[model samples]
Target: MKNDFDWKPLALVPALAILVFPFINSGSTWLTLTVAGLAMGMIIFIIASGLTLVFGLMDVLNFGHGVFIALGAFVATSVLGAMGDWTGSDQLWRNMLAVLPAMFVAMLVAGAVGLAFERFIVRPVYGQHLKQILITMGGMIIGEEMIKVIWGPAQIPLPLPTAMRGSILIGEAAIEKYRVIAVVVGLLVFGLLAWTLGRTKIGLLIRAGVQDREMVESLGYRIRRLFVGVFVAGSALAGLGGVMWGLFQQNVIPQMGAQVNVLIFIVIIIGGLGSTGGALIGALLVGLMANYTGFLAPKAALFSNIALMVAILLWRPSGVDPVTSR
Candidate 1:
């Protein structure tokens, strides 16, 4: 059981990367694009992980998750706007002081909204997925309007802090410092999730509830409460991802989250609905494929992930490692 987490699917990431390298030919260019892809994939994993737990444990299909992402990025704007001095500084430490607080505030606000969303929109159609999808989508539409009202419909520029503004050269390859940071953050998140879910009692209960909710309830543990907690945590992670994505793009718009929602869904489907490990693998593959395609054929960049998803689905329709099967 300890070794139940499969590592075989992860090989696709490196395999894909290696396969593309021969096409690119230039070592430095390949390295640069590969790192960029990995960075993007890690950011996606951060956002998708929460949904994985929510769906895996609660069977809740929340289409409004994008709202939380937009909220988090907007919240970061306010927090960072107030700390202009820190973000404007050349010192990395000062920038972190501003960013760390913004991240906290974004997570807090997103998590709070998640609670209300659970109470109102999601709670009613607990088992009706069709209603859940329709209502949650409506929730997203309204949330976008609300965001436009608060932040204005115009795209707000979210500049990188001075400390992370440029790239470092590594043997003719330029790697952005922020991208490396994203990779570290993603690894940390994955490690934390693996530890919490695989090594802790609470994690045990969560898994137990997922497998059989009634049994856990009969044992005096409240499954509803756990589900709520999962939703909040998932929302918080989406918020965290929002902040990262905003910084990555150096701009924020009300629809930014919705635009990303497509990719998130692709990752979920590719990863087999509720599997975290599968999500990571799928995300990395997507990121790599997008970059490779963009460089090799710019026109195909927009549909690269979609194409990858379809290919993956055709090969393994249930996903690379479907949680339902496990």
Candidate 2:
């Protein structure tokens, strides 16, 4: 294994931030936009992480991943709705008591559904990329229909907890409380993932399995089980992300996941598919690009990320850091 670290890709986040600082002009607006962009990027990373994990380790193309996202969000609406007193409270701690449990329930449900999804929808199509893509997309459509049935076809409000609403002033810049929380949560998730995938025995085995499945299996480890666990975990992460995304939008809809799917793919592709670190960088870049462009040129907001993706590809055709190349 190569022991050298590449600081270049990592620097892109700050470099991009500095590059856009001047165009944003006002210090307050820049600060606000930067925080918002980072929060958005973090949420995107959470959603994309699971699909990337499944693809990297299991080599399964799960186009249906968005279903878990919507599922989790809808589930949160129910959970938070039921805990109205907790969520409605003015105390942040009280609000968290409700939100945390909602997150947990969402993850649990999404994971259970993911287990079934893998068994019924993904298993037969293994190693067939074309079949995986078509079938999994079909699965997503069905999953969306199921969501509409459970949550109704109408959009549902997912208001933030009382304490999480509004903004806290940082100098002249006003930042939403939830956005700050989002940035912290995203950082925590990234840190945990980096540690889990790099420092532990399971991480070692998973990496080894990806590189040489037969070798790992010959050593008496159940590679199949590991892959299944990864799928479930990935689904759970997506569910957690769904809860966050729903709150970020302050609403829940059956098709929300499908809408976010476009951004998720862009992030992973930019990050060099299946690379978590790359995903973070890709997500942040996307978030920053979207926010900056949206503020500067509203008309170009829609195509900004697409343009950004093209630029990145032109520079690194295989992505910022493809796992295969690593």
Candidate 3:
């Protein structure tokens, strides 16, 4: 009976509602929440994409992924600040161009960190779940403390370019340009990732590895290289996410990575650990839920994600596992 029903249309309902909700509740708060939710979901996608790949392909649970994000944000912020000082203007184009170098540097640093982690830390503990969890948690703590020490405890404001500081009128609703940029960037990244995974040789190898690591290894494939590659890619993605979040939130703090760690976990779990499509869908769902719930219960915004997590667990313990025949 379940096979007889179409799920594609059901999936579209959420997007449809997002478009129509503004008409129903055109309040500044609602509009803002909608935009914020969209922006947050995009950020989640950026981080979760790499995470899902690593977990799904390499079977590694990396708790320190949040650290990569925090590091990326800090590096980007520092670069932008320096650029602003040199250029003497916070113009949108200048800031945007400045972010390019920041992104590259952040990704390189994050990738190097991941490589070192895989070589020294994660290598010995491969397949040892308990040890992996313990070591990764310790790494997370170290990352958080390092940020506090280096950047201090205060929240550092990330300066947005003057042009991107305002909003645009969409019908009667005012939407922030930064939010628009976030959505556009998110879509482009997702699309590119989808294309690469679907069409590229390495992507095929990764998917094949996810299905059966032993089989791929037996075929003379260098599983270790693939694992390292996945880890580096994942870390780089997290770093990019941090940079984007810094721009969107306008603050960089030591504990910021810790704060978002749970949400990213929930997103991957809800979306299915190994599936990119699942991550994207889950992020959007969680994002919208958090935004809508915050409207009815501003104080309860913290619990919104938890509630969604519980619901997803109750409904599908395997998450959105695409291979599962439900």
Best by TM-score: 1
What is the C-alpha lDDT profile of model 3 across 1-326, one tens digit per residue?
A: 01122244237326634664764455665667677778778888898899888888878888878888898888887787778743344576666677778888888887887788778778888888889888987887888788788777788998676667778886667888888899888989888887777678887788778777899999999988998998999999988999888888888987778778888999889877787777887777777777777676778876877887777778878675442432
Please report, as a residue range, the 10-residue window in candidate 3 with the lowest summed lDDT.
1-10
List of clashing residue pairs for candidate 1: none
Counting only residues 3 or more apart in sequence or on different chains, how many pairs clash (N, Cα, C under 3 Å) in candidate 1? 0
Candidate 1 off by > 4 Å = 1-4
Return the clash pairs for model 3, or none. Answer: none
After superposition on all CA atoms, what RMSD does each candidate show versus the true structure? 1.4, 1.6, 3.7
Which pairs clash in model 2? Answer: none
Query: For residues 1-326, could you state the per-residue lDDT of candidate 2 as single tens digits?
Result: 32222447978888888998988779999989999999999999998877887787778888899999999999999999999999999999999999999999999999999999999999999999999999999999999999988789999999999999999999999999999998899889988887777788897777666566788999999988999998999999999999999999999899998899999999888988667777888888998888889899989986999998999999998678676665
Candidate 1 TM-score over all chains jointly: 0.96
Better candidate number, 2 or 3, judged by TM-score: 2
Total clashing pairs in model 3: 0
Candidate 1 lDDT by residue in tens digits, 27-84: 9999999999999999999999898778878788888999998999999998999999
What TM-score would every model get versus the actual structure? Answer: 0.96, 0.96, 0.90
Query: What is the lDDT, from 0 to 100, of the residue 217 in candidate 2?
Result: 91
